[model samples]
Target chain A: MELFQNLAQGFAVALTLTNLLLAVSGCFLGTVIGSLPGLGPSNGVAILIPLAFTLGLDATEALVLMTSVYYGAMYGGRISSILLNIPGDEPALMTTLDGYPMARKGRPGDALVLSGVASFFGALLATIGLMLLAPILAGIAYLFGPPEYFALYLLAFCTLGGLASKNQAKSALAAAIGLGIAMIGLDNSTGLPRFTYGEIHLFDGIDFLVAIVGLFAVSEIFIFIESHGKKSAIGVTLRKVTIPIKDIIHCLPTMLRSTLVGFVAGVLPGAGASLGSFLAYMAEKSIARDKSKFGHGNPRGVAAPEAGNNAAAGGALVPMLTLGVPGSGTTAVLLALLLTLNITPGPLLFQDRPEVVWGLIAALLIANFVLLIMNVPLVRLFVSILSVPPNILLPGIMMVSFAGIYSLSGSGFDLILMILFGLLGYLCRKVGVPTVPIILGILLGNKMEDALRDAMVISNGEISYLFSSGISIGLWVAAIVGFVLPIFLRPFLKTPPRPAD
Target chain B: MTSDRIFGLAVLAVALFYLYSATAIQLGFLSDPVGSRTFPYLIGAVAALCGIYICIKPDPDPNWPAWPIIAKLAAATAVMYVFARLLKPMGFILPAAVASALLSYLISPNVKVSIIAGICLSLGLYLIFRAALGLSLSPFGDLF
Candidate 1:
């Protein structure tokens, strides 16, 4: 009953003219940004943080806008995947297994509609899960002390070690690099600089936005330049955009199963949409009576991954909102943005700032509906957006990124740092080191240390306090299980089951 | 594969240097029981261990970009760095225009389209950021 009251209040806030306009514009921009290959939700949200700040939006409105974009980008990624065999974002890799083949079979419109419908179902179901589960999780999180929090952070790291890259050693190396970077600047506990090397600018630590833009956006531009203006072969012509009712009914079970699988994976701190969708695709393939049709223009293949990824995106938000631990790269960016707003997200966030928390929830539900409406009838229009050449689009993005970073920091050195990080990002990508875990490490490293220190202080430096509590011990056990479980499953989830490109 | 192994060695060197720096961090008497340097020490150790592992057995060599592509990437990066230096001195529009023009030209050698895009992006972004959003980006430095 109280949840109903809070949600009603949230609706009142989200329905206002300013918030509604923000959501609509964010959705539109997110779709366009997400439709572009090489720029995923993390970059989209990261680049837009400065725009939100420049616009002078209060924290709540800014969050609403960014979260809307986050959802929009996830929804928009499917358009390119289905029409052109290229996955717009990493998680969309599974969609191309059947989506491209279906498009090649001259039912481009149908493939898109099915994916769109699946995305809509996944997003809606996941949002519903977030709404229901976040409160309960938040309540449980209230009991978490420093040891529990430290254990949770450890679990996150262990999970990332398992999921961030194909090679655990490489992923561990990336994470260590991130932690080392985070160790720069003044250490608050001791009032001493660690890696400043006598530079005055290093007193305040590296800006998260600068690191993010450089890694995700600027390095992407480098890759685009390397392509020398190569365009995807999007030759599919769309006549109509409707799925038969029977097809929708047939895929309903696949959608439901994927939503559950995605939601579960997403709620965990390391299993993101890519894993969720990959698992869902594998599950669907194994269970299907005709396994041969799994990747050869099967509509269920399109539906399962689409639904799973979108649902997982929603699921990823639960830990971020309730426990202040982001489950995925994009959510990590969102958590950083929230921190910038002086809003520490945790169990206390619900008690203290129900408006911001519940309002974001309400906005997400509405935004998913908006994406469904926009994507179903206007997907062809969205696809044509691809014709905007990278030459034009890429420069415009660079300008936006430059202007945003400059305006936010008013520091030229941050710009210099951004480019340097961009080069590092390019090098990392070239070396096949996944950068997401590095970013996650940077985001969580300080907090993890603080939690550990706090626990030690509370326990009077007792080493055994980390596992003294049941919750902490359970988290440790879970972390061990998560790290070991993926190795056994590697045979099935081997490198996304991809064929030669 | 050899390049990857060398890269792993480079990582190991960085880790060693980081560990050295971590040792130099001055600690206060009343600092947290775990202390600040312990975390960095742990990070350095993890990095060193991983670095050694990768050096011993690295992934297959990823396809490095050709010389021409590398040249183009370098030019693009140089343009962005120069744009940053020029942004505050010359303001948003002029540097943005020139940088966008340079970038677009790099992508496509067509001068006319590049120039038009440069103009549109500079003025248009100026309007969006300055006029619409009220961000304090000067149109012509602090001359106004």
Candidate 2:
């Protein structure tokens, strides 16, 4: 009953004219960005952060706009996968395995419409799950002390390295570098500067937004430049778009089961959409009557990953909202947005900012419907986006990044700092070091430090105090297991088609 | 010999430098029992250990691009640096236009199309940033 009341109040806030317009535009831009090869939801949201800030939107409006883009990108990723055999992003990689094959068999229109419906089904159910699960999770978070939070953050870093990257050492190094970067500027407890090198701009820490844009957007331009604008050819020409209702009904069960698997994967810390999609596809394949047809343009192949990845995308938001810990790379970016807006996301957020939470939930619900309605007729429009040449797109992205960063902080130093981070990101990618943990480390470093400090103060500097509680002990055990289990499991788990967020 | 080994070496050097710097932090009188330096020390140690591990067990082969591609990437990076440096002195339009043109040219060698794209992007972004978004960016810096 209270959930209904909260949801009704949410609808009232989200139905406003400005919020509606933001949601619509965000969805449109998100779809276009996501359709571009290699620019996933993380970059999509990172690129648009400057615009959101420049518009001076309030907290609810900004979150609503960004979350809409997040969902839109998940929907849009299948476009290039089916049409060009190029997964638009990492999670979309599984979609390409069967999506491109399905397109090659003709009936490209049917393949696209079926995937869209599956994405819609998966995302909608996961959003409903988030609505019910987040409140209970928040209620439980109220019981967490400083030790528990410290242990939880440790678990995040450990599992992120263990599960997401091919090399846990490199991921650990990236997290260490990120924490080192976070330690710059004036210390919160002590007034002394750590790594400022006497620059006045170093008084305040490096802005996470600058790091995000530099790493994701600017490094992308460098990659594009190296490739020399060569990959814009469309592989499959679309016939007339169709509804494909029969395929939708046939794949409904696959979508349902994949959503369950994906939601669980998404809720697990550091296990994101790529794992969800891969697991869903593997699960479906194992249970199929005829295994030979699984990867050879089977409709279920397309439907399962599409649904699983989208559901996982939705599930990643649960930890982000309820516990203030982002479950995925994109959610880490969103966490940065919330912090910039001066909103501390956690159990207190529900008590203090009901409108922001409920309104965002309502807006996501609306955006799902909007995407379903908009994607079918606008399929032709989004397909055109895949043909946008890199020459134009790269420069345009560069301009947005530069202009946006400059507009945010009228400081030249930040621009230089951004470029430095861009170089670091490029080098990390060159050496197969994952960038997501760097982001997670930067996002969580201060909070982890604060939690540790608080715990120490409470326990009079006894290290055993951190392990005294059952919850803390459990988290520590989980962290150890999460970090170690992936090494042994690596042989069994299928290697991802590409590096994931 | 491998790119991973070189990267690992670089990380090692950075971690050592960071550790040295961590030892130099001046603790305040009212600092907590854990203190600010403890976290940095822990991070430095972890990074150093990871660096050693990566160095000892580096990946077999890394697919590095050709030297020509590396040169082009470096050139593109130089343009971005210049753009950042010139953003304040020359205003948004001039620096943005020049940087966009240079970057476009780097992507493809067509000069005319690059310039046109540059002009369009700079102007289009200006309108979006200044007019539509109401951001406070001067078009021509202090020149006009």
User: Considering every candidate listed, which one attains the maximal TM-score?
Assistant: 2
Candidates' RMSD to native: 1.7, 1.9
Give per-residue CA lDDT, model 1, range A432-496, as digits (tens): 77777778777777788888888999999999999998999999999888777776766666744
Please give, for residues A207-298, the per-residue lDDT of candidate 2 as tens digits: 99999999998888877776654555448889889888887899999999999999998887777888888899989989999988866788
Which residue pairs in model 2 clash with each other?
none
Per-candidate interface DockQ score: 0.80, 0.84
TM-score of each: 0.97, 0.98
- In model 1, pairs of residues that clash are none
- The clash numbers for all candidates, in the given order, read 0, 0
Global lDDT scores for all candidate models:
0.86, 0.87
TM-score of chain B in each prediction: 0.94, 0.95
